[model samples]
Target: MSRYETRLEDYRRRERPSYRVFEGMQELVCSVGQLHNNWLYVNVDQWDQDPVHTPIYYLDEHWLEECAEDGTAATNEQDEYIPLWISDRQVQTWFELATFESVVEVLKAAGKPVTLQMVIVAVKYYDKRDAYLDYDEVKAVTDLWFVLTKVRNHLTE
Candidate 1:
């Protein structure tokens, strides 16, 4: 049997009642149905006959501790207990560039004029970690101040 078939068979034999799966920003309460390459087939909707194949990397741990601490837990449309799946990438983008003052200071030290567009572009560039950040393609603002601080510290050392 192929690797996919082997994994699917193994999943079938497992006695676990439920599995928590994530797809990008959404969390899914599911049961393992099959495993193909880097994806795991999950049955998300009991009424639906088809299962969704999600990337294995998106599998997340349950939120038992978080629920206990907060006294609240996430649930699906069916009111089934589920954990919230917050995207690492989204968190990195959202609150990463909260402070622009520090970034302005770094730019001043580098002899670069502090302009609104320049700061915006710089934030985008740092967020992507890409060699080239096209003006039209900048999707998120990253924490450039954090990166600049690290680079400055390294140079001084």
Candidate 2:
């Protein structure tokens, strides 16, 4: 069987009920681009094996601990940039959920210029760590801030 076929069969067999928005939806996943319009993808095997696909964590270390309480975890190492893979649908949700206050708050929390590139990176990587973010405290602003932290971490500056 083809890998896709095998994975589909596996999905059928798992028999668990969860709202994994991107579960088995590999095609919708792509690298968090430097700009909102940008994107990248590769063979699933490459994503599984390549260190380059890891997120450049941009949050303060303490918030990672905070996020752990909310069930998101992350791993990364300094390397050439390719960007962490995330779900486009989840990103769209972030923007749809966004309010003007949310956007301003996220940008302020970033504690820098919060340029267009940074906002793009935040959107693309918003769902990198989980199938969906489950915590009530995680507003659009908070989620954006989390990924922005990843963007900041990844930037060489």
Candidate 3:
């Protein structure tokens, strides 16, 4: 099986191992809830009350090596990469994009019109959900909004 499949199986069995977050400062103890858009939906026990999606890159070799050296890493022979933690910055970006995508999907499913206001609300919700917003997250939301706005305008026209 591929590394991704092995991780998925681990998640299904609720076997979450600890991994290091950004700069190896914090550890994330979580299980995989789902996968979407090539990202992992994880249920972090340390911070979030709910599951959150993060980029798969958090499990890349470099981060894993740092975690291993610190004795905070968790993996097995069947695993190629194990994601143990997510940085504050990564969480923000992931939350923003994932929430926005979810909102869009819900609107589509309900056959409701996707408006600028809806997208704006999604971004605002994420901004307020966290204690503080990172500058990179702010930029990411703004950039996504710009692109969405263009798409919306084009579709309407």
Candidate 4:
């Protein structure tokens, strides 16, 4: 069987119920553009499906504490850059789950600027781990920030 088929079969056998809810959904769909540069342009609005996605959890360094049981956790200078599309989603999701005040706090907690690129990187490589964020995962986090920002900005204006 092909890699995709194998993965599908393995996924079917897994017992994790949470992952199952978003099973079989496409992660990303690409749109072709006739740009001069060799780059792919993805439209966040063109996602496969719309659902309630959020980043209700914090990126605590404790989750991977076990890996450093014998000593302090190893650190690395692994910087990541998330595509602009995912960043917008993060802002959207944040807008939905919290009020303008709360959203601003979360953004502050996450650090300043709150740029689209930074949000995308958070989703793609949040807390310097969990590289494989599936579509639904991305959607939830994006939705939270996306909605929150709108509300936050409106309140300010």
Candidate 5:
């Protein structure tokens, strides 16, 4: 194959990312030093090189869709790069990356709509439901959820 054809073949055969990539990705994108670590966390080969900036355009969006609690596809069309494309398992493996502040930043960065309700959902789903947080962490989520619910009700009513 010619050089261009070889590159095209490689791109067509791209593999799905592994769990470790999601783990590293969440850690890298978390609040600690996140501003400078927005690049892709790891290569498929799991190397420890500098951050790579490969957009997942080659991946199937359906394969990447977020699922409901019962495992059905959550179909409102998340429409943001991270929320729409990351797998449910990836979200479960994610930690600090799903906080309300980080979520706001993600939405804003993607130029997607950000709403208080959506923030509440992100906290509930990613932090409370998906992550394996401890008692104190769960309590923190409860507190945040309580306050956010009150605020949303007050604003909407």
Candidate 6:
């Protein structure tokens, strides 16, 4: 019915989040970066937009619980902003963006002032399980499962 309802449904249906092959169901959080390229990767709520400076009063801790209780009614309590975890793959994307110099170009296109500091965020999902594990039985969830690289040039500094 509403966006929250849709997300809740999606979560309920998805027991596993990432789209990869894993040995088993292991809930983990690791700080990772790409060696080939420097990018900061993080896990976040896929639906939330880029982080804002101010404290997002819109979302509270109980917000997620509310969604769990009632998705359609909890639409207003949604606050999927804060990132849950970070990964290394995201750094690779930043490295690519930097190599192409597209990062600066993108900011300019969006009218966002180019700065030495930047935060890139992406939302993705994964489905990984062992051969013995049934795809339907193993389910996990992840948000912003991509790398977000930030780079600042000399001019910005």
- Candidate that would win on lDDT: 3
The candidate with the higher lDDT, 1 or 3, is 3
Name the runs in model 6 displaced over 4 angstroms. 1-36, 46-50, 53-101, 109-157
Q: What is the per-residue lDDT of model 2 for residues 35-102, given as tens digits with 9 covering 90 to 100?
A: 12212222333333432332222222344455446655333332212222332211211222222223
User: What C-alpha lDDT, on a 0 to 100 scale, does residue 12 get in candidate 1?
Assistant: 67
lDDT values for all models: 0.36, 0.35, 0.41, 0.33, 0.38, 0.25
* lDDT per residue (tens digit) for residues 37-116 in model 4: 12111222432133123222111223224434644334322221223223343321211111222222344453434443
User: C-alpha displacement of 132 in model 5, angstroms?
Assistant: 36
Error of 6 at 16 (Å): 34
Superposed model 2: Cα runs more than 4 Å off: 1-94, 99-104, 130-157
* lDDT (tens digit, per residue) of candidate 3 on 1-157: 9999996675576422332232211111121122222323232332243222222232334546777778665553334334334332223223322343454454345454434444444434554684333344444676787899999999999
Model 3 / residue 28 / CA error / Å? 28
Candidate 2: clashing pairs of residues: 57-150, 58-149, 58-150, 59-149
Cα displacement (angstroms), candidate 5, residue 51, comes to 10
- On residues 1-157, what C-alpha lDDT tens digit does candidate 1 reach at each position? 9999996786666544233334511122232223211222223232122223322232222433456357554544444333345222121112111122233334445553344444446433543463334333332333455577789999999
- State the displacement of the C-alpha of residue 110, model 1, in Å, after optimal TM-score superposition: 3.8
Which ten contiguous residues of candidate 1 have the minimum total lDDT?
89-98
The superposed Cα distance between candidate 4 and the true structure at residue 2, in angstroms, equals 8.2
Candidate RMSDs in order: 17.9, 18.5, 14.0, 18.2, 17.1, 19.5
TM-score, prediction 5: 0.22
Estimate candidate 1's alpha-carbon lDDT, on a 0 to 1 scale. Answer: 0.36
Model 1 TM-score on a 0 to 1 scale: 0.23
Could you tell me how far off, in angstroms, the CA of residue 98 lies in candidate 3 after the best superposition?
3.7
List the candidate 3 regions with Cα displacement exceeding 4 Å: 1-97, 130-157
